[model samples]
Target: MVEQTIIGIDVSRDWLDGFCLPEKQRFRFQNSPDGYARLLEILQGMPDDLKVGFEATGGQEWALWRILISMGINTVQLPPAQIKAFALSMGKRARTDQIDAELIARFMAFRPEAGRALPDEKLQRLRALTVRRAQMVDARKRLSAQISACRKQGVSAELEDMDSILKAFIETQISELEQRIEGVIAQATELSAKAELLRSILGIGPVSVAILLAEMPELGRMTATEAAAMPGLAPMAHDSGAMHGKRVISGGRRSLRHVLFQAGLAAACHNPVLKAVARRMKERGKPHKLVIVAIARRLITIANAVIKTGLPWRISSAA
Candidate 1:
C-alpha cells in the first residue's frame, strides 16, 4: 500500500525550506523560477495525491503557490497565528523555518480539509496600493506634527526648508498612491463594481472598498456571523467559575477593522438603514459606539450579500 504524503514549505526571500512527512525529509530551494521547477520535480516524484501546506509570510506563498496551482497541485495557505498556535500545542516552543515547516506538516496531517487559497492577482495589486496609501497617510500625519513642532520651537531657515521638503514629499506620495488606486479601479471592473456597492452604504468609499475587495475576498463567500467572526468583529464568549468577563473582539486583519470603524461612524449618521438601526439600539440605552460596531458588522453582511449575489444596494420602505 502506498503511503499518502504531507508536505510543507517555509518560504522566504532568498530560499525556501520544505519538509516532506512520513519520511521527515527536507529540501532547500532557491526562491526563483528554477527553484520552483526543482520543487515541482520533487513533488512529481511523490505520489499523485499529495497534500501541501505553507504559511503566508510577506506574500512569499504567491510565487510558489501560483506555480503549484497552475500545474494542478493542491496547496493550502495557513494563517501565521494558526501555524504558531499549532506549534505551541505540540509543545514545540522554538521558532525556525524548519520547525515551522514541521508544524505545518503536522497541521496538514490533522486538518486535511483546510481550504485552498487561490488569491486574485488584481486584488493583490489593490492590496499593495491600499497599504502604500495608508503609509502615506501616516507620513502626512507625522510631517504635519513635525511642522507644528518646528513653528512652536522658532524654526530657522534650515528648519523651514526641511519641514517644507518633508511635507511636499508626503503629499507627493499620497497623490501617487491615489493615482495607483485609480488605475487599479480602472483595470478591474468587477472588483470596482463590488467596491462601488460597498461604497453605496453612506460611509464606505473608494479606499475602504479597495481594502475590502483585496483583504477580505471571502467577505461574500461566508455567512454574516462567519464574516464578522473572521475579522474579529464577533466578540469572544467568556465564562469562568462564578465570574464573567466582557466578550471582546480580537485579531484578524487590523487594516480592515480600521476601515470598518471609520465607515461605521458615517453609516450611523447618514445611512438610513444603519441610522435607523443605531437609533433603535440607542433608544434601548445601548452605547452609541457599540451600536455603530453592530451597524458595521451589518454593513459587512450587506456588502457580502451584494458581492455574493452581484446585486446593488436596495433600501426597502417601511410600512
Candidate 2:
C-alpha cells in the first residue's frame, strides 16, 4: 500500500483553491474547462495512489466531482460541517478557501471512509429529479398557505385569482415532475426493481420512493441503525457519568429526513405494521413526536431489509 496523495479542493463559482498533501502543494485555478484540464495535468504526475477530496459546496462541487470520477481519480465529497468541526479540533481558528482546501485534504487522510463514492449515473439523475420535486412541494405548500390567508382575509378578487392561477401552475409542474421521476426509475433496472420493492410497503408512495432512492443510495449497504442515522432518524443518546440528558436527532441528510418524516406520517395512519409500532410507543406514554421518529426509523429499517434481501414487503402483523 503506497502512501497516497490526498488533494483537497475548495470550489467556488469562479475559482477553486486546492491543497495536495503528501506532496504539500497548492493550486488556484479558474472554475472553467481550462482549470479542470490543469488540475488533471497535475494529477497525471502524482502517484497512482491518489485520493482527491472536496467539500459538497451545494452544486458547485458537482462538476469537479464528476470530472475527477470520470478520470478514474479517487474523489470524496466531505460534508462541510464535518470538515469545519475537524478544523476547530485542529485548533485552526482562522479560515479561508485555501485553509479549507488544506483541511479537507487532511481530513480525508484522517478518515478514509468519510465520504461517499460517486453514485451510479441513474442515481444522480434520480437525485436531481427528487430534489427538484422537494423544492416544488415546498413552494406548493407556501402558495397553499398564502391562498388560505387570502381567503381568510377576504383579499381582492384579482389578487385571489392570481394566487389561484399560480397555485394551479405549481401543482401542474409537480405532476409533470412526478411523471419524469417515474420514467427515470423505469429507465434503470436496479432502480425500478428496488422501487417496486419499496412501494410494496403500505404508505410508501412514488415521492417517498424517489427521495429514498436518490438520497439514500446506501440503502442495502449498511445495518438498520446505519441506514436510520444517514437520514438523521436515529435517536442519539446524551448521557455521561449518571447525568442523563435528552436524546436528540442531528447531523444527517436533511432532505432525506424531511421526506422520510412525511412518509412516516402517512405510514403511521395507513400501514398496519408501522401503526402497531407507533401504537406501542404511544401506549408506553411516548410523545407523538417521539413516536413519529420511531416510526420513521422503523420505516427505514423495513426498507433496508427489503432492499438487502431483494424482496417485496409482506404486510407484517407481528411487531
Candidate 3:
C-alpha cells in the first residue's frame, strides 16, 4: 500500500508558510507567481499520493490554490475554525505562522476528508459576484440608515447631498453585480438548469438561487439532513447522561445561513408546503425564530430532493 504525503500551509497576503508530514519538512515562499513556481517545483519532487491543504485566508490563498490545482495537485481548503479547534486539541499554546502550518498538516493527517475542494471556474466567478453584491447591499443599507438619522437630526445640506450620492453609487454597483451574477449562471448549462429547479420553489428569488448555487454547490448531491446542516439550519442536540439541554445550531457557512434565514421568512409566509409546516410548529407553541429555522431546513431539503430527482418542485413530490 502506498502512503499519502500531506502538506499544510498557512497562507497570508505576502507569504506562504508550509509544513510537510511524514517527511517533517518545512518551507516558506513568497505569495507571488515566482513563489508559486518554486512551490510547484518542490511538489513535483514529492510522492504521487500527495495532498496539500490550507486554511481559507480570504482571497489571499486563491491564486496559489488555483495554480496548484491547475498543475494537477490535490488541494483542499480547510476551515479556519476547524484548524483552531484542532490546535486546542493538540495542547498547543503558542501561535505563529510556522506553528499554524504544522497544526494544519497534523489536522489533515488526523482527518483526511476534512476540507473542501475548489469549485469550478464558473462557480468561482459567481461566488465572487454574489459576495461583492452582498458587500454593496450592506454598504447601501448602512448609508441609508445614516441618511435617515441625519434627516431626523436636520444635518447639513452638503452632508445629505454626499450621502445621497454615495447611496446612488452603491445601488448602481449592486445592480451591475446582480447582472453579472445572472449572466454567469445563465451561461452555464448545468447552473442554469439548477437555477430553474431552485426557482420553482416559491419564495426562492434570483438572489437566493445565486447564493445557493455559489456557496453550497453540494446541494443536490447531499442528503436532506446534510442539506439542512450545511446552512446551520439543522438543530443540534445537547443531551448528556440524565441532563437534557436545548438544541442549538452552530458552525456552517455564515453567508449561506444568512440568506436561508431571509428565504425562510418568505417561505414561512408563502411556500405552500413549508407554510403548512410553519403553521403546525407555531400551533405547537414553537418560537417564531424556531419556526423560521424549521421552514429554512425544509426549504433546503425540498431543494435537495428537487435537484437530486432532476424534477421541478411539485407539491406532491416535495412534501
Q: Pick the candidate with the highest lDDT.
A: 3
Q: TM-score for every candidate vs. truth?
A: 0.84, 0.91, 0.94
| Model 3: lDDT to the true structure | 0.90
Between candidates 1 and 3, the one scoring higher on TM-score is: 3
Candidate 3 residue runs with Cα over 4 Å from true position: 1-3
Write model 3 residue lDDT over 50-155, tens digit each, in one string. 9999998766888888988988999999988788888888899799999999999999998898899999999989988998899889898888888999999999
Among all windows of 10 consecutive residues in model 1, the one with the lowest summed lDDT is 310-319
TM-score of 2: 0.91
Residue 299 C-alpha lDDT in model 2: 87
Model 3: per-residue Cα lDDT at residue 38 = 94
Question: In model 2, which regions exceed 4 Å deviation?
Answer: 1-3, 91-95, 145-156, 317-319
Best by TM-score: 3
Per-residue lDDT for 308 in model 2?
95
- What's the TM for model 1? 0.84
> Over the full model, what C-alpha lDDT does candidate 2 score relative to the true structure?
0.87
Each candidate's clash count = 0, 0, 0
